[model samples]
Structures are given as structure tokens and as C-alpha cells.
Target: MRILVVEDDAGIALGLRTNLQQRGYAVDVCASLASAWAALSSEPFDLVLLDLGLADGDGGDLLLRLRQARAAAPGALPDPLTPVLIMTARDQVADRISGLNLGADDYLVKPFDLDELEARMRALLRRAAGRAHPLLVHGELVVDPAARTVLRAGEAVELAPREFALLLLLLESRGRVLSRQQLEARLYNWQDAVGSNAVEVHVHHLRRKLGEGLIQTLRGVGYFIPREDGA
Candidate 1:
């Protein structure tokens, strides 16, 4: 999954980025609210790790802006229902309630355990994906998002990080087509040099590992996985 970390503390941001990356998540870190806004506006992040105290302004403002974008016209923000996890040193009850009221999925106080953060993130992601369980099943394919494991016909299938991410996205949007631009935004950050055929390469690898019929490409359009009725 792709996660954006908005933290002003250099140490905290570095730690978050490193730990999340090691856990097989694409992470982007920014110190100021302006940078965070730019990143959120440009990319389709699966989740956001926000710190209330930012260099430029309170993260609450950014959270409000995110909600506003979601309430705007269609396509105003990629993934309008994206989850936000607020992390800050403020541990007061009012602070937590305020953040949650502002539409944050979870609130984490500073000096928290990384394991706990990850667990909360997983819960939010599952909720956002409309998944009651960590395991997502479609036909003979079973994907354990938390474990980052895929099983087909009761057999395990190993996949690279990018490949796994791509499959997960497709699974989440099983009946809908995802355009190339949307896939690119979800798969890559601004700093990454995305090749013209990056998504195509990942899709090809996933198909080879899963099945050729798993992902269908629309001519001159996008890609999608057929629903159960094969519509």
C-alpha cells in the first residue's frame, strides 16, 4: 500500500519512512503542510499518517482540506475515501475526539509502538476496502492483505512488492476499470521515475503469476478484472 507521512520531526519522519518501507509499503514523507498538500493533491495514497503539529500549519487544516476535496465534484481527489491516521504528541481526550470528529480514521499519540500503528493502519485499510476480513477472495484467488500473501487454488503465490500492490488494487476494484493515470498515481510518487510501461510491466508479471485471464486490458483505455458474471 502507498502511505503518506506528514511529520515535521526529521527523526520521526525518517523512522516512519524506513519502517513502513521495510514492511513493503510505498511511503512518502513531508515536513511541512504545504508539501503534504501537494503530495496529497497529486498522488492516490492508500493511507495518510498525519502529525497535528506541522512546520507550516496544524495538520487539522490539512485534514479539513482533504474532507473538502472529497466533498467536491467527482474526481476532485483520487480515492476520496482514503483513510487518515493522526499521530501527534497530544494525548488529551478532547484532542483525540477532535481529530476523530474531523474524519480521521484513527488517532495515535506520540511515543507509540510501531506494531500498534501498523495494526491500526491495517484496520483502516480493511475498512476502506469494504473488507470484513484481512483475506480477500475472488473466485479461486485469495489475497491476505495484512500478510501480503496470495493463494490461488489453495497454493501459495509469491509476488514482488510492486506486483503485490498492483494485484491488491485490482482486487479492491474488481468490477471497475482503473485508468493508467490512476494506476500510476497510486503506484508511484513524484520522486520516482515512472517509465511509460511501468504499470503494463507490473500487470504482465501479475498475469503470468496468477493467470492470463485474470486482468483484462481495454484497448486504448484501462484495465479491470471481470465480475463473477463476467460482465
Candidate 2:
């Protein structure tokens, strides 16, 4: 999914952007609240990874602004329950409660692993998607989350853990546009589970096995799987 990453630390921001990108997310980084607001205004993002201590202002204010904007322009917005994952150095119980109260979907303490962040993100999105471990089906392509089976054209398509996770995300939202951030969230627990070109590598292999048209890449956005009728 499209993600806006609001962070001030250059190294941390770069690391996040790079890692998320490698995992098949379209990530935009902003070092300050002002830029965060601008990015939020300019384009539609499925989720956000916001750092509280931004250079321009508190991330809470940014969250408030987003809520206010959504309220003001309800019809213009895409996803009403846009997930926001808070990133903060404060790990106190009160701090976590405060962020959640301020409309943050979840919070992560600093020095946390990217994998953990991704898992939390997946949980948030899964809630927004209104399903927990939902099964995905597209024609002969069936992905059973519980069974961990992938079948294309009625033939079983073998996938590694990461590959299965990636396919699950695509099939979960079949016919919907899923930016890389959303996919990255599925791989949160397994950092070394993939290489730099992991998403691309997996997608290539998936297309080869499932058929070239199964997963279509949206230029400058991400990937998707259309329903059988559309195909």
C-alpha cells in the first residue's frame, strides 16, 4: 500500500524507506510535520508510519489534521479507516495509550525491529480490511491462509513463506490496488526472509507460474490481481 513515512532522523528515515521499498512498498519519506501534511494532502495513502517528534511539529497534531481533513472532505477521501502506525521514542504505557487515543492505529517504540513494525502494520490493515486471516480466491487461483495452499489453474503453486505471504496479500485484495507498504507489512516478521529484489523476484515467479496476466503491475503505484471476469 502507499505509505507516508514521517521521520526526522536521516539515517532512520533512509533505512525505513529503503527497507520498505525493498519489501514491495511504495514509500514516501518526510522529515517534518509540514511535509507530512503536504504529502497527505497531495496523494492518497493507504497507511502511514508517523514519528511523533517531527522537526516541524508533534505528530499528534498531524494526526488530528488528517482526521479533521477527512471529516471536512468525507466524500473526497478514499479509505475512511486509513491506518496510522505511530513511531515514537516514548515506550511508556501512558504514551502508548495517548497515541491510540489520538487515533493512531498502533504505536512502536524506537530501536524496534522493522519486522515488528510490519507485523503491527499488517494487523492494522487487516482490521481495516475487515478480516483476520481472510481467504482469497480468484478463478482457479485459490489462496487458503489457514491451509497455506496456493493453486493456479487448479494446480498447486508452491511458495516459500515470504512468497506465500506476498501472494496472500495480492489475492486478499484481488482487483484492488495494493501498494508496496501493504505487502511489506505481511513480511514484517521475516526481515532476512527476502533480498533487495525479493518482491520483484517473487512476483516474477508468481506470474510465470500463475500466468503473466494474473498479477498486473500498475506503473508508479503497485501490483494487483483482477477477478476472473475481468481477466
Q: Which candidate's TM-score is highest?
A: 1
Candidate 2 achieves a global lDDT of 0.75
Question: Distance (Å) between predicted and true CA of 186, model 2?
Answer: 16
- Which residue pairs in candidate 2 collide? 1-179, 1-182, 24-180, 25-180, 25-181, 115-188
List where candidate 2 sits over 4 angstroms from the true fold: 71-80, 142-231
Query: Local distance difference test, per candidate?
Result: 0.87, 0.75
Model 1 residue 160 lDDT score = 92
Tens-digit lDDT track of model 1 for 1-231: 789999999999999998988787888998998988888776678999999988789999989888767436645554457799999999999999999999898999999999999999989988987877878898999988778899999999999988988888888888889998888877766567999999999999999999999999988889999888887
Return the lDDT, model 2, position 18: 88
The TM-scores, one per candidate, come to 0.93, 0.67
Query: What is candidate 2's lDDT per residue for 1-231, written digit by digit as tens?
Result: 556788999999989988876665657888998877766665567689999988778999988777655435642443336789999999999999999988888889999998788778767766776777655667777676545688777788877766776776676677787666556544542223545666788888888877897789998788998866684
Worst 10 residues of 1 by lDDT: 70-79
Give model 2's TM-score versus the native structure: 0.67
Query: Residue 58 error for model 1, in Å?
Result: 1.4
